[model samples]
Target: MAIVKVDNLSVQFAAKGGIKTAVAGASFALEQGETFSLIGASGCGKSTILRVLAGLQRDWKGDVELMGNRITAGKRFQGALRREVQMVFQDPYASLHPNHTIWRTLAEPLKIHGESEIEARVAEALEQVGLPSEAAKRYPHQLSGGQRQRVAIARALLLRPKILLLDEPTSALDMSVQAEILNLLNRLKQLHGMTYLLVSHDADVIAHMSDRAAFMANGVIERSFDRAALVNGEHRMAHA
Candidate 1:
């Protein structure tokens, strides 16, 4: 069962000096309940592809399907479609509201979707991310980097999304904190049977978290690798 299907996707930006191609003719698919990663150096179109799938960047040419439904460019995602997928951004500090309490942050999504039981869901999400309920009372600034990122994860999980698009989920954290967040993500995915589309530059992170990975460069996916092959130092790079 393929949960996400992208084909011939291309994105360009109108920079001050003419246009810049951020993603060109990229295509990939993600199976349900599996972790798929895109690995490459910075500015290699990995994050751009993630944003496109998340429906944040809609100006692109291609076919994007989630759960078998085609997602047309420029069509606003609403109701069930919007709720089915959620994204966890790269920068914890930037992604979260500095002044809002964690409780408010977690509850906002439920409120937008007109869902009831906000308190219960928020508490459960916090617990699921291994954060104490008291942590919800604190502001983003009051929490550690890992704790803040956990809150971000908790916010995404509150909606019970089927697919999670992660962008460098632990890049800003310390090594120990990175391990903790990665483990938390793994546990949550297993418990919820969720699918993941993670983007990162670190091969070790890709090996630790992904079942399969695509190496992206120069606005295209160059090659795909199984986790075992990547871990064993065996990979073949082919241009897209």
Candidate 2:
């Protein structure tokens, strides 16, 4: 069975005396261990789609199903379904708490989910992201941009999510740090057998890492590409 499925999903918002559609009807499915990337220009509703899948924005019309269970838009998704789907935002600095140490930040999710052995898992999660155990003692300001982002990735992985929603995860980092984060994401996917739903505007980033690439324009999917077509840039979709 597909781990995640979105059928005829659409999202709209109330603008100045008019309703604007942020995401038009779109449909897709993700299987186990698959990396599907959505690439598009700004205002193309990429983040809006991720928000719908993450259950952060519920004011929408669609059937979002995970493991055969339907998800209600804009509602607080709970239970195992919530844990199975996790998101890593683009900004690590804003995502991490300035007051909390790395250990506390990473352990917060497990604590919220009532997962035991938080300490042990925090250690393991850090190691998985190539961060040292000593990193637990530092605050967000103490680390570099790359290190902070890795910590954000580690925090998401601490939940051991079945499907990861990454929204331009490496966009804010330097080129060198971007490569490191990409490598870490690729490695972690293999190690945990997790499916990834990555959203980015960079074609090269999407082409190099994703097993399949889907282009979004004006709130709709223009095309989907396989591995070979992505590398060759020979797909029918408009490259944003």
In Å, residue 218's CA in model 2 sits off its true spot by 1.0
Candidate 1 deviant stretches above 4 angstroms: 235-240
What are the TM-scores, per candidate, against the unseen true structure?
A: 0.96, 0.95
Task: Give the alpha carbon lDDT tens digit for every residue of 121-201 in model 1.
Answer: 898999999889999899999999999999999998888889999999999999999999999999999999999999876
* C-alpha lDDT values of all predictions: 0.88, 0.88
Model 2, span 81-189: residue lDDT tens:
8888889999999999999999999888889889999889999999999999999999999999999999999988888888899999999998988999999999999
Task: Please count the clashing residue pairs in each candidate, in the order shown.
Answer: 0, 3
Q: Score candidate 2 by lDDT.
A: 0.88
